[model samples]
Target: MKELRADIERAGLDTLSGRKAPRARVLLIAGRPGSGRSALAGELVRQVADRYPDGVLRARLSEPDGTRVPVGRAARELLDALEAPAPAGAAEDELGEALRTALADRRVLLLLDDAADAEQVDALLPDNPDCLAVVVSAGPLTGIADVRPCTLGGLDTKSAVEVLSRFTGSVRVTVDPRAAERLAEQCQGQPAALVLAGGWLAARPKAAVADLAGQLNADLGQGTVVGRVLRLVHASLPASAARTLRLLSLAPAGLVDPHTAAALAGCSVESARATLDDFVAHGLLHPVGGSSSPQYEVPCCLHPLLSALARDHERPAELQLARARMLERTVRLLQSCRAITETDSLRAREKLLEMPRSLRFPGPRAAADWLRVRRPALLASARLAVADGELDTLARRLMSQLVRAMVAHFGTRAAASDLYDVHGLVLDVAERRNLPRERAAALLNLGDLDARTGRTADALGRYRTALDAGREANDPYATGRAMESVGGAHLELGDYDRAADWFGRALTERLARGEGEDAARLYGRIGAAHTYAGRYGEALRNWRAAVAGHRRNGDVAAQARALSELARVQEYAGRLDESLRTCQEAVEWAGRAEDTRLQAALHLRLADSFQHLGDPASAALHRGTAERMLAEEALEEDSEPEHGANACEIRSSSAEE
Candidate 1:
């Protein structure tokens, strides 16, 4: 690899080391599509990674289909790689600022690969002179200052021959050195072409090097060397392998696992695995991921060729069918992925048992590992399905399962950014199909994420729109949810009167639907909103209602919480004796609920109320009890085994129900 671009590597390293600019040193590795610029940049990163003690970060600025990835999305990807918090629904400029701030003090290496233009790279460049950004683009970054483009071309003949030998072996190249050189020349020393040619030779072991060279020379047409070589290799594949190769184009983002391949090709997992391995052997596919569960990536240079093959050989209907089948299979996998975490649920276990062994994850850890590894491709699958505009049912199923699986494994907060995007896709499908119920659902989800990320105004807009859609669909559940969400958004924005009104509306809906628990939650929300607005009388009434509702539902913990709120409202109303009585009642309920934390908190409240009522002895006694309760709870927590902690803890939204 060093022999292939030793000079370029040396020059890049020198430039990065010598620079002390106001911003990151920018190095542009410009090349044609198949000239191995990405590979060379990767090699340079490997060579100089130690210089940057912070870390190395990479992001692809363009998708496999040449679509320019949005700058905000790219920045989010980089932040995720850094394990930094990136707010959902942030503008591109904000995300860019965040990215720069993240790298401002750190000596890091940023590999901005396959960038579309100067602006794309500039948006992501850090302001730290100690950092370096090596950008791989198809052409010069015209607008950037103080940077020179290192243009890459085909490899030199000697290095090309070495690359070839790694695939075809040395014996063939050594026995017929002239033919090997001719074959390398025919490939024009392009690494992509060389690999394909080498694979072709490797496949036909008995055939002389001259034979493939003659075939390529005869087949030279109005196309790229890589294209011609890909055609030749593809043409030589056995029927099953050829079909698998063509179907691989359907894999999202050119990322394929055996299960996806199996689904697309309508074959068994074992058969698909064998065909994939064969493609790897012939350089038609590149092995990625770990050896434990191997995945493959189709080379971007070959995407067009494979796509053309699929278009020519496969019917449109057949292609659509294949896509639908792939999505359905993905849904099932996601189901199993989430179900594996429900260890206590017999229904989940039954679902897992019904699935094929290959589709089921061994346990929650393995499921999470698989989800992490496949996140990019799985997201791509959802995006592509939505963009297809013809598979709304399958797309909806795929997205629903995707969201649940992410929440099950990564929790909502950790996965909020991705969830935001998926919810947008869901909205797109809902709008296109004119499905008001689904639209309302999607909007509510997006609003929840927006609220979590502190975009309360945006969340308010979404929730209001969702409310309209729910009303149009006459879905009481959705309508109630939208009302509560809007109220939560209003509460966050400090519009407490409007928040209370909306929460009251949601409470009415819940009551009419006989949802006692939800009604109790909404009553608490209304009470909180009233308290925030300094309406103590209204707050006390709502809190009393909340307490009564929870009692009717036999929810002792909720009743205890409601009663504690009532005590605070009573104190706000200057009813000190009433506050004391409410606190004592809350403490009793907390004890009955077996919620030690709540019990301790209520005792503290009781102590404050006793002190306010001028009862020193009772105040001192309750304070002592509260402290003892807390201390015992702490000891119990310390004694618990470390592994008992659930890694897949789902975080609830901070927004009131």
Candidate 2:
């Protein structure tokens, strides 16, 4: 035991002053393991020994199992301290009276260590003013009504370092003060870790405390003090709370809404909420920022502990089940976010019908806020599923919904990064399942999103991967989609030849299948790439073929797209009459298709066409229509066919469309 020489000397005041000067009636010393609780109590006993003529009394009221020590046993010890003989079968009430009567007019001192509870100490407390009582326990005896209590946690930094210095020797701790401080912090202010860590470093006194802290941190897994602490805390929790805490540790964003918590825990919201506060009281979590709705985040200090606990305690099947629940909840939220945004979408209406009544978030804004805050956690969860192995399918499904939600809300930077991560995971899942069609689909989506976000190189890589996957499956539709994405990426990268080659390949396959919308889209893309390369005649021909195919297939958005490309080609060809005619036809097609942005652009083109045709009044009228439509977006908002394509800029007012 480390001598308590310093603290012992300071405890001198315990004996010198009595009740005549408002004496120290209670000397409550409490601390964690190896923190001198016994030593401090011993020194205080020595200071007050002279006044207590009846002599000192000591009682231990704890079992290793934490079951409370019986009050009768404690009473017996107290009676013995009073030199009162009691029969072995004495009842607790009789012993308590005998102890109180014995100390009624005498000065006495009591030291009760590792006490079990209030009742154990109640019988030992001296009743007279001439007595001093000391109590020590791991927790504050909150159930105790009368006696003042002192509960111990950990030593403060200075005292803790001082305690460590006793072992490491003064020179080392004094030499590098800052490293010593960080060592204390890494110990998590726990005296046991500090002492163990100090002993670890002190054995090799030449070693830096910082170096030891680093090495110890690197090795802080199942065998570490931190690990044991989690095991104990986890084992100490109720079965239900322990399960919930494990599942919640897997939450990506740290903060969770009550519904998500319920979904993750497989419990009612009220139950999950109660569990949440229980953790908070134990200093395991803290409140998260923002309150578009209120949220609570698990503290970082507790995260590693929770993680270790989950890894150690949760069986694979149990953890997988928990993950499934959280993902199911995520998919529901993603669908909800989409549904609440699009007023006329039948899919949206149907999704809403399927939503659980307890699917919370008071309003659309509230839901958005929740998503914003929990975004990191959700994304991290997706990553974790893939990393956990055998969870490929779950990860794929999770990423699909996650990408949709990310696209609908959040910035390009965040969404693009998320898209890349999900797409990467999707490949692994597809490979494992031997689902080439699904692989192609995943790659195509990732590539398309990448191209839209201006990540041309990344887009090309994904597109080529999709092409390979499609060829392996011998799936013509998947292959055609892959080619189209590759063409788009090449066009963005200024590789006109490569773009045209891929587009032609996609077009031939689509034609063989007699899929006109598929054909129209490829033809329009080829036309655009040709136009970008200044190949006017080829662009015009491809655009005309695209327009004819789109019109025959009743593909309104495709028709408008082809018309816009053809008009641009005609305008660039320096044929004023042909350009004017094409621009007017483009406007007619856009109007027919209810393509707002295309219509607006066509109006502006018409203004240019009229100016070239020497009609100033007509040009002015077209210009106003174009400007008004561009500003209001009334045509687009009211348009029945607002397609998901990169043809127009979508301005998300929030993370929602």
Best by TM-score: 1
List the lowest-lDDT window of 10 residues for candidate 1.
Answer: 645-654
Give each model a TM-score: 0.93, 0.59
Report the C-alpha lDDT of model 1 over 185-212, residue by residue, as the tens digit.
9999999998888888888889898999
lDDT of 2: 0.69
After TM-score superposition, the amount by which residue 66's alpha carbon in candidate 2 deviates from its true location, in angstroms, is 32
**Relative to the unseen true structure, what is the C-alpha lDDT of residue 518 in candidate 2, on a scale of 0 to 100?**
79
- Residues 1-657 of candidate 2: C-alpha lDDT, one tens digit per residue: 123223323333424553232322554565654454655677767865886787788876753224466676577656755666444334578767777777777777788876766667666676675677777766566554333444455668887788678778888877888888877876666755565566556546677877866665565565546455445455557898878877777666466667667887899878888877666554455666556555687543345566666777788787778878887777777767655655588887777877776663456666567676666567667766777776676677777777776666654443554566577677777877888988898888777666665667987998898899999999988888888888878888899989999999989998898887878878888888888898989999999998898889987777776777687678778877887787787788788777677777777777777876788899789878877877788654665343456264222111221
lDDT of candidate model 1 versus the reference: 0.87
Off by over 4 Å in 1: 1-20, 614-620, 635-657
